[model samples]
Target: MDATTGINIAKVVGPSVSIATAGAILSISALYTPLLSNSARSQSSSKPSPTVTLPSIRFIFSRGSHFFPQAATFAAANFGYLAYYSANTAVKVLGMEMGTRTGFVAAAVLSIAIGPITGLMLPVCNNPLREMAELERQGRGDEVDEGELKKMVKRFEWLNYVRGAAILAGGVLGLAVVIAEGK
Candidate 1:
């Protein structure tokens, strides 16, 4: 690969590593919140709360941490090889003259930017719905007073689709930037 492609690939490596680390941290936090909340509730209550049978965050982290490096290595190897083959095949089929350096630059930029952008936006779109569903499942289903419920419903109706669309737009913007720069 050319110097530009090499630099681009190297630049992406740090970001990808950071993204993986952040994902691990977020997963741990998700587990911790429920465990800590349950612990606090149990401590305050006369009757012990039902045993929370959720998986352990620490255990998941341990297992995931152990496997992540290997998984990342395999993924990088496979993905790089696939990109090489696919780009070569496409160039041959289309009678285009693009170099592997260009392909590498494109792939590196797109993957680096898109991966974390999607990672960041995914939680924004998903967390509220997940929270609302969890609340409903915990017996808070549509139990708000009529006036409050109406207000909430109206607010949600206005905001829900907007929030989702914003997440999508953010992802698209990231991809667009990568493509524009790579090209």
Candidate 2:
């Protein structure tokens, strides 16, 4: 491809990747929101007798919450693929400068890393929800171990923040690519 064509492709995909990265960051923030955590806590606290079956975890929190992070992961992955392509185009096709090339490379690497890291942590993060669902199925949600739940919440929070930071870093690197392309 010509330099102009490669530059144009980088220009187009850069903004798209930025937006998706932003969305992923926002969604990750929501996953650890106080309100959601409070809701889960309240639901757990208000459970009926140990013998009575409680509603599934799916019912406790908004079902949409469960799917949002997954969608964010998909979006992150899409951004990674596009960023990788754009970085390649910028470096190989467009013959961008060393600094510019390095930025794109960093962006591409971060984006690529973000998707899998988030995907892997997602299940680990959602383990509590899954456990709650199983507890409900067993009619023993009231018996949930608070210590374990707290530990799970802490793990989820920190891991998700790490994922969000990865996206933020990726977004910044993408901006670097945009700036370099403008030169």
Best by TM-score: 2
- Checking candidate 2 for backbone clashes, the offending pairs are none
- Whole-model lDDT values for every prediction: 0.38, 0.53
Clashes of 2: 0
Q: Which ten residues in a row have the lowest lDDT in candidate 2?
A: 47-56
In candidate 1, stretches whose alpha carbon ends up further than 4 angstroms from where it belongs are 1-77, 82-96, 108-114, 143-183
The TM-scores of all predictions, comma-separated, are: 0.29, 0.58
Q: Give the per-residue lDDT digits (tens) of candidate 2, residues 1-183.
A: 875676566555654555565565556446543333334545655322222212422442346356534544543454454445554434322344454445655665565565676567658856565666578677776677544554554555566667666656766666656766565
Q: lDDT score, residue 93, model 1?
A: 11
Model 1: ten consecutive residues of lowest lDDT: 46-55
For candidate 2, give the lDDT of residue 92: 28
